[model samples]
Target: MSEAPIRLLIADDHPIVRDGIRGMFTADPRFEVLGEAGDGAQAVELARALLPDVILMDLRMPRMDGVTAIKELAKLGNTARVLVLTTYDTDSDVLPAIEAGATGYLLKDAPRDELMRAVHAAARGEAVLSPSVATRLLGRVRAPADPLSARELEILRLIAQGTTNREAAARLFISEATVKTHVLHIYTKLGVNDRAAAVAVAYQRGLLTLDNG
Candidate 1:
């Protein structure tokens, strides 16, 4: 007997995006587009109601973002695997979604065949990531073993928030030279030569987080 088509729920803020995804998946016999949601809240609701085998989730939404929705689903014991489809490839976006229990992360620019394969993999509870995201993840995984000291981590966070070395020095009651030294140490430890790359690597490796407060 033929297997059942994979049931799918799409959650994206854009109507046209939803339309395109729905049309693409519905055209395939191996998949079924069960429903569409305009935001994470609606996605969570529909996911509970429909119990789709996979959910194509977008990162940014109205009520809640994809990561929060994924966390909520996990908390509520929802069994559907989440596959993130978004334009964002930054570590800030990819790391949280994956950490929040996303089964896969795919860029919006991915080919139709790749999206189909990602959906299939997600339905099977496998992890999938776009090539760029995979490379970023691999780099983080292979990062140098030098861990940042507590003060260096603090200075890195301040830099991530757009603080200048002088401002960080003032905030920490340290000399500007000390802050610069710490910044350099952070760069070396994170395997990056610049402040932005250091912060990005920090977030990717779970050393930094979005302060909701």
Candidate 2:
């Protein structure tokens, strides 16, 4: 005999999105669309009754957010795994949902095959993450050294060349006030207070060199 299909509960604010996702699963015998929820609150309610293998959660819902729903499910000791499915993959969105016990994270842009695979993985209590989300998590793990932006680096290079903030602003053709803001950010990033100290730290970090010598 064949193995039973994995049951799914999709939760999204849009009826159209829920329908579209349901269609995807309905076309395949490998998965079963148990129910659709219009909001996180409804998702939690439906989950109590449906007991699906995986819940495809959306982060921003009207009644209760996805993260909150995941937390509630955990509090209730529900065995079903939560798989976050949304367009957002920023740190603010990805980290909280995972911390709330989401078994997987897939962006809305993911290919259909990947989405199905994500659901299957989630059903088995395995971790799933969209490429962008995975990259974000990896970046968090190996946080960058200088958090300095490209513009900030340009400003730092000018400072290394002994240019005043005004001169740098003039060369960059930006407002002096804007340049001051970049300078402040550079100082904060380099952990320095003044221009000279900022320059010293930049050289120590190999962000600058006395190329003239």
Candidate 3:
């Protein structure tokens, strides 16, 4: 007995790129290329229809872009994990794709083996990134700057303690607007756009301690 091959959709504007990816996946017994689309709109439609397990998406495409496609797919409740395959390694491209719910990012020049590994990882709901992209993400995360003020740190401590912003503001005797400002500052300080990341950073840096009572 054997496990079924992972179904995949390849979405790229270049025929050569799509063909190359198709070849690579076909070579692996664990993967099956179920469909291919040359643009983002068609990709979205095919993904909705086919419901592939993974989507290999290129960032720049005609009619619609990969970021928009990823967002639209998520909005439509598509469960396929999008794995971005692009030539661009810039923060602008990477961040937007991740924010749009892409599960992975890989360079166009990635070796066949790495691409295969990324495909499998993305299929399992894991985030995969090239080493350079990982370095960039870590650099952003570790930059030493107290983007949060003293007041913001206090607010973050409360937040980590599971306090709502309104509750934190009430406890601290501050306005909700002031609490929001502190939260925004905390996000900036941690170089993260969300509360989960901010909390993780605070916990990692010993800025937030847990009471396991």
Candidate 4:
């Protein structure tokens, strides 16, 4: 006889996404949809009640974010494996969810088959990451540090906040020429040719994060 289907809990704030995923998984004989949650807080509640074998979690939610939910689940000593399914793969999103005890991370754009494989692996407590996310993690591991200096990071933050070079120079009380030079060095070090790309790469490398507050 075939093994029992993997019990699953689907969580996401979007109804369409939840319904679509539910439809896909419910049709699969190898999986069973135990329940659904609209947000992270609901996810935690349902998880506690259902004790599913796997949870398909979304990072962004209404009440409690996915990371906090994962942490709460971990705190409760819940062994259900969490596989993150979100539209974001930035460090701010990926790192926290992983740190909070996610067994895998897959972007929402992942192919249906790939997502199925990820869910299966997650049910087995195996690590899975989307191609882009895995590549970013590998690059971080290899480089292993904030490549830019403190000053560069500051400039990158300014750029991220839509600061012009002149404005950044004025804020730092530096000459525009010096600011331009720093921008060039930042571009080269980040392997990007422009300011926007530099700021993006900085966030990817964890050199910049969303507001701490």
- The candidate that wins on TM-score is 1
lDDT of each: 0.91, 0.88, 0.87, 0.89
Which residue segments of model 2 deviate by more than 4 Å? 144-213
- Decreasing TM-score order of the candidates: 1, 4, 2, 3
TM-scores, all candidates, are 0.80, 0.69, 0.68, 0.73
The regions of model 3 sitting more than 4 angstroms off are 144-213
What lDDT, from 0 to 1, does candidate 2 have?
0.88
Ten-residue stretch with the least lDDT total in model 4: 204-213
Choose the strongest candidate by lDDT. 1
Report the candidate with higher TM-score, 2 versus 4. Answer: 4
* TM-score between candidate 3 and the true structure: 0.68
Off by over 4 Å in 1: 154-173, 177-213
lDDT, candidate 1, 9-58, per-residue tens: 99999999999999999999999999999999999999999999999999
Model 3 / residue 87 / CA error / Å: 0.5
lDDT string for model 3 (48-116, tens) is 899999999999999999999999999999999999999998666777788789999999889988988
Residue pairs with backbone overlap in model 1: none
Arranged by lDDT, best first: 1, 4, 2, 3
